[model samples]
Target: MKLDESLFTVPGVRRGLRFYVTGPTPCPYLPDQFERKAFTHLSQAAPDALHHQLSEAGFRRSQSVAYRPACPNCNACRSVRVDAQSFSPSRNQLRVLSRNSDLIRRPVEPRATREQYRLLKHYLVNRHEGGGMSDMGFREYAGMVNETPVQTALFEYRQGPEEDSPLVAVSLTDILRDGFSMVYTFFDTRQPKRSLGTYMILDHIRNAESYGLPHVYLGYWIKQSPKMAYKKRFQPLEVLDGPVWRRLEEDE
Candidate 1:
C-alpha cells in the first residue's frame, strides 16, 4: 500500500503541511469501536483522477471533501456505485420515479437557504433525531452545504414553478469529470409518497447519462443496515471489494 507522495502538494491553504491522527473513536456504521482517517488536501491539478481512485478505494468526498479509513482494525466501510449504463429500475422504483415527475429540478449554486434549512431540520427531527446531525445549527448547516473545492451544486426539487412554498427535496452533488457523487440529500419526509431519496438517485443516474458519464458513486452500502439496503434496489450495481469494483449479477 503506497501512499501517494503527490498528495503532499495537493491544493488548499498552503501554510505548510500538518498531519494528525485521531484518538480511537467509535465507528459510525458499526457498534462498539473506533475509526480513524488519514486525510490530505484535494488538488485541482488531478481532481478527477484522484477522486476516482480514492472513491474506488472506499474514500468519501465531502464538499471539497476527501476522506478514507485509517482505522487500526475496522474494515466495514465499503464504497458503492451504480452502473449507470446497465441500471434498470424495478416496478416499485419506476413508480417512485413517476411520482416525482411533477417536481422540477433546478441546479443552483451550492448554498443554504431558509426553506432548504427548514426541510433539513424537519428531516433530521423526523428521521435522524437520535443521530449525530440531529442538532446541527444554522452555521453548521451552512458549512455542510457551502464549503467545497470541486464543482458542486444544489438540486432543488419543487412541485411547480408557479407554486409557492413548493420545495420538497434538495440534494448536494459533485459534478465530476467522469460522473457524479451524491454528497447528501434531505427532503420533506412528510411527502413520503414521492420517495424523494429514490427519486434523487434516479435523477442523478439520468443526469450522468446526459453527460456521458458511466457511473454514479454512492458513498457506501452495508449489508446489515436496512438504511443502506435500498441501494441494492438500484440493480446492475457494483461494490468495492478489495482493490477492484466487482460487478455483481442482478440476483447476486
Candidate 2:
C-alpha cells in the first residue's frame, strides 16, 4: 500500500513517517460491521521515542507497526490503561492473585520456543477456535514474538516455583518508557476457574509498580464487546479521548 503523505502533516510527527489506511475488513469486535486501521511503520531512526508519542495518542504496536482503528462511523474501540501507582486490587482480584500464587512468572527474551508455541496452539484451539490467529503455525508465532522494533519480552507463567515447571500461561509485553503494554496473552483452557487471563493483567500491574512505571496499557476496551469488558475490572482505568487521556468514571 502507498503511504498517505498527508498524514505526515500532523504536528509532532517526523517528516519522513508515512501512514497508510487498511481496506475495510469484517470487524472482529462487533458483528455485522467492518473495520479499518490507520497505521505506520516504526523506523529505527527513533523507534522508542516515536512509539511513546504514538502510544500516548492511543496507537497500539503490533510487531514493528503502530496502528489505530480508522473505521468510519465506529468509535467502539477505546484505548485503556491502568494507573499502576493508584491501582488497588479488589477483593475478588486479590483472591485471583492468591489462587495463582503458586505460579511462577519468568521474564524471557523475545524469542519463540516450542513449549510456548505448544501452549499457544492449545489455547487457540480451545478459546479462539476459528479466530484470525487460530490457524497460525510455529513460524508465524515466532515472527509475532521476534519481530519487534521496541523493547519487548515474554512473561511465561509456569505451574510451580521450579524453573522447569509446566507452562500455564504467557504474556507478550512491551516495555514502554512510562509503562508496560500487554501486547497479547494466552493461557491453558483447562482451568477456567483460575482466571489466569485476569491474573496476568494483575501481575503486569505489579511488575510495572516494581519498575516505577505509571501505567499498564491494557489495549482497547470496547463497550459492546464481552471479550473486552474484563478490562474494566481494573480500577482507576484511563481512556484516551481525542488527544487527552481521562479517568474512566464508574458509570461510564
lDDT of 1 by residue, 95-165 (tens): 98888888898888988887889899999999999798999898888998888777788989898876364
Query: What lDDT is reached at residue 185 by model 2?
Result: 97
Q: lDDT (CA) for every model shown?
A: 0.77, 0.90
lDDT of 2 by residue, 107-135 (tens): 99999999999999999999999999999
TM-score of 1: 0.86
Against the hidden reference, what TM-scores do the models get? 0.86, 0.94
Q: Pick the candidate with the highest lDDT.
A: 2
Off by over 4 Å in 2: 1-11
